[model samples]
Target: MANIKNPIIPGMAPDPSIIRVDKDYYIATSTFHWNPAVQIFHSTDLANWKLISYALTKGEVNLRGTNTPAGIWAPHLSYDKQSGKFWLAYSHMQNMAGREFNSDSFAMWSDNIQGPWSDPIYLTSIGFDPAVFHDENGKHYVSILEWETRTGYQAPGHIVIAEIDLEKGGIIGNWHRVTTGFTTRGCAEAPQVYKHNGYYYLMIASGGTGYAHGIEMGRSKNIFGPYEANPSGEPIITSSPHHLFSLGDPDSGHFEMYNPKSVMQKAGHGSLVHTTTNEWYIAHLMARPLPNTKLNPLGRETSLQKMTWTKDGWLQMIDGSNLAKMEVPGLRNSDATIQSDQLNNIDDDFNNSRYDLRFMTPYREQKSSWVNTTEHPGNLRIYGGNSFFSQVNPAIMATRATSLNYTAQTSVSFKPDHYSETAGLGLYYDSNNWIYARLCQSDKEDGTVLRLLQAKLGDRIDYIFDEVRVPNNFAEIKINYNLGTTQIMYKISENDDWKQLGDQLDVSYLSDEGVNGEPGEVGGFTAMFNFIGSVDAHQHDSFADFDYYKVINK
Candidate 1:
């Protein structure tokens, strides 16, 4: 048997929904505030994954003013062999302000995976993280979390199941309160339903989404009824599955529930898939934090665990231990060859007519007017729009920083006439928290100058160490990210030795549990990104031509 690595898809690819059609595997993940919503990844062996297509194209959703940790949430993908169609169910998180968590869910269908998908069919806005289940009778059912707003209720609310009509885009009848949770491990959401054996199984993400996150299961002979919890009386699988804590806590982030012995933390929100080999596996979201700390700057990532059926008919990891493993056993004699350079390595020469699907922009659709590789062959031309601080529209293109230790570099030739017009390579957690090393006009000289700046919750800090005047408009910028600290380096020419712009900046605050000064805010769940961008407050006509963009993970 081959060894399947954990975190099959890393760097912010959370809430994985997996499905298998013949020999192929596909997993759809959430893209908060990033355009081209609902990233779809394809994998043949489950070890190596590649970005293929997005469920939503431009004009599919409006994320113009979407805030941190809000936008497209969980996306569920399923294929109906009987109908020969693919269905995608997703939630568009419009607002999370004041913790109202207003969202709209919709479903789209296509004859093919990579498709001209049909227009969205409006689904219920009961809560979020909706999934479609097709039974043997060819009927469709939706399992969703009914978000409770009233005080003194089950804090985050229950998982409800209801029959839905695909064409009508509405429930057939009243919703069924299936279960609050299989166990007292409350804060259960992201419910997915599957029919196994003669029983119907309900899988949920429980114990909050922080240190206590886990996968819980219950099964019943009926689709909507009183479900019985797994005999373990606790999470069937989790990073801290052995650490019994918070069976009664009503809120999330029971930081005490963190499992120090395990390498994988916050392992939960699993989706199950049965392969052609009849092997069972669950794809879940797990986070790998820095050593001896819970600071997860990489955010929740996608992980896999080989599963098996108990003699009593419940599903669980093949091993009796519930702890997530760094390596899982693969199918015997499987011939899936994985590519060597799919994660944490990006070399973009920008000669292609279209931008790589790996790159994404926040809060707005990537349009040719703002970003174009064809405009300047071998270079990416990005015309500056509003500042990155503005969520409405920002001229930025980035990829998830899959590794904490990596070097991100870019070659740019931007002639910024004013300080308001700048272009550079940097790291971004959100508009409120980001560090950009930009080249702009020098007030002290005729040539451009490099400056390192940091924005934390709209407050800006400009680093003034040693300002170097560029000999020409062309400059090579590099950022060496070492765990939570980053060093910005630059040189006038590629042949010249790199120069440090500022002392290493501590950026540990740019994480899911950090930043965002809003009261009662749970920080942001979105991970950090490596970006190449420009800010133009002087004139929108200013553009930056990036000769190349590259990132090498250490």
Candidate 2:
């Protein structure tokens, strides 16, 4: 009977972590600084999702200069069914510079959910979203958030629970803190635990992701708890519930705000699944913001609601209400075939071995000498390493302009001719903002030239086109972005027709949710990238032949 109105999984998917296995369903998200991080999806009828595979592709962790929401937070995803394995739990948020929140928590396991996975296993410096549960009797728990920088306690955050051994990485007992939620909302973090029937529940994520997020719950017979809340004490799911007290600050008793009226804004982290026919759902994490203008550009997405259970067993929402929507009934549509084009085709002729799950690379480790398929078989040879503001290293490989009216074309045949080679085509949003459209050579005018630089935030480098000679061998470069009205166009192809070398760029501040409050604020957490870079400081072996790289989405 499908038709709750669609939107089973749309853009920017955030902290969701579902799992089913018999009827097949899987989901995992959260990629803070965006590398190869964690983003996996696959569904049967939870309403179509597809994009399977990506659980971090080794760099082993070191998100070079991470910031703007800090690299990789929340990420769970379980499945034990008695050692059929599949676990994953994360948090690598290395320092938020003065926001302090240092972070480390890790764990990984796989028997197969499409993974070779199994290197990370640090598990716990504790202070970032981490969840893992196994107990039916086999035992293997982990639920974190001990982070509390001290001071009269209460709101520093606390909700521990331990008992894991996984071949001696440690954690045998004594950690239990349990209930620290429900004051109004402090910073209760992604916790998750379940048992059902006899009850054990748990499921947290309280205010403070912005606008007082929520999704609380508690219950206990034993698993280590006194737990109770949920007599409608509030937050069964939210999106502004009067703003939840506003979420965390009553001298830190928590639940700071309480303003639920709904239009979807910072809904709450969540996960819980059942459906094979048993029915039940809650995927959570929502945020639309833009109508009145809060500007959230698809970030924090992944929604679902539809729940039941309460003969007094508790667990509402099936229309009982707490916000969270986009349809949720018995659910069983998705037979596949909903392609009006799901938008994602930045065009590349690299000839796959895998590297177009919408490319992304920053903060180190993804080197085959910048890129290579044995040099040039189908074309994708980007060598000229180091230099993007070098946080450690940079060769760059982006993708994600998804839409705002688009048109990014590329075709280069560079020979930058020395003086630190440089191959072009970029739009990036980090390392302090970006915008490039290069194809250098001019060393006092002899040939090859076509520039239009700008680096902002990271500082110095603003050329805006100086040597425009067009047809310099195998040229072709286009940018075009409209984004409603930020207007930017830069074409170059001359005689074959494309002229218009530069001067239209208003760049509406390169949004995704950027350009709001600047001055050491830097584009609010990123979401604008479209690159193909190379910057060798005169090590020069120079090779750039990208016969194709399209993206057209008006």
Candidate 3:
């Protein structure tokens, strides 16, 4: 089974949401404020995948100060062959300010997709990608995205669809706008619903998510809709297949709809799946920039496409070309065998106390108080929080810089007696961009140096004459990065040779169009991260340990 390439799950794993439930497929992505939020992946070979679970681990939701693409956005995973259970639908976007994009869509369930889940059920705050469609006789709709603050109408709204009564948790009536986009590339949000053959189709995600992202469709035998579009009104999947008039644009950063011959760029938020050998795949959400640079520091990933169905049922892209393809053609005769560390390079060595569910942590909730591998059973302590320009407790742990060229080492032992403590290894992209190199506490004479700290767009530099002295706070901190440049190295033994702690630093602003939001928007859809952080702010008793994080992949 080879030929299944294009990110079958790579890096930040954006809007995805696939599902299968029989030969086991499961996808579900978008964890906008990190943490054990949404994510969930597992495959039986639609090209090997496996991050297992996290349907919002338990606190169920509350991404602290959440703002930077605003926490937990699209996570719809459905499965209910007549209440066999497993639904999930999400969105807790909580305010995007003057855009009034405030959100709160929920819905949860689980008879186990690897969950204990079953708490949220709220269902609508009016806008923000929510999906949930399980119609057949057990009826239950719930498409969403009605967010349009009428300045002229149709800027980013209207996909609506209701009739959800999950045993009486709300919405069994009004809300049915349906279709503000069938292409001319409007900012139509994620809709998703399907019924096939007798038609009830309706899939969306158009134009906005940068560079004219797409994946659009429509049909109807009346699931509520006049739904008919898609006779090549364009976009059945896209990496900018030309012709874009942008209907009321402003979902942010159309960047002139960049498609320099496509290396897979913003290929739309999709999620379709059929395969049990009847085959049909779509798992979308792509972005790869950083060469001639439109700069996407590995955020928004997860691709796969190979659809087909058109005798008059319409759902193209199986070489019919709506563009977007890095190689797709597996699972039709399936031999299944492609998981040699699925996409390699994340060598973690925290030695069994466990710490690699692809370690995420950003705006809080990794809890063990402040992260712990059972109090350093082998290493990976991390106590010190706040200060990485606090988005409330930045005790970073990060992971997901999935290659634009990688290197990322780690070795911190950290001992900062003050100067507000610090620990090392960096990259991150929130709390206003980042670079960080840190080791701290030299304020001119009390030892342990290594400094670098930067944060663009929200300002804060502090290289402090590029300090370097590290004689024993234990050093190893690396970073290579490449593509948009970044060098920052160090060494203190284990054969020593790294030493380059300065120059070469462009970091392409850590990128999601390089941070800075809310005043004309476009910054952070959650991407680049390498992390290993710490920061005491004076006696949280400091803590960093860490002895092994390695990321290799060049």
lDDT (Cα, tens digit) per residue for candidate 1, span 48-150? 8989999899488998988788899999999988899999999998877665778899999999888888999999988999999988898999999888888
Give the CA lDDT, 0 to 100, for residue 153 in model 1.
75
> lDDT of candidate 1 vs native?
0.86
lDDT of 3 at 455: 87
Clashes of each: 0, 27, 0
lDDT of 2 by residue, 30-104 (tens): 877777788788878776676778787877687877766578878899998988989888899877554447899
Candidate 3 C-alpha lDDT tens digits along 1-554: 56787787777999988989888998989888788898898888878787877888887777878878888889999998987999898888877889887888888898999989888989879888888888887889888878888788768877989888886678987988878888788888889989987889889988888878888989999988889899889998888888988898757568888889878888988989998888788999898888887878887889899899978889898888889887888886678654432375888778877788888888788888888888878788988888888887789989888778878898888878888888888888788788889888898657888889888887988888888887878888788888879888888666888889768788787888888766556777788888888989876877888878989876
User: For every model shown, what is its TM-score relative to the native structure?
Assistant: 0.97, 0.35, 0.37
lDDT on C-alpha atoms for all candidate structures: 0.86, 0.69, 0.84
In TM-score terms, candidate 2 sits at: 0.35
Could you tell me the lDDT of residue 153 within candidate 3? 72
Number of the top-ranking candidate, with TM-score as the measure:
1
Q: Deviation in angstroms for 104 in model 2? A: 12
Candidate 1: residue 23 lDDT (0-100): 89
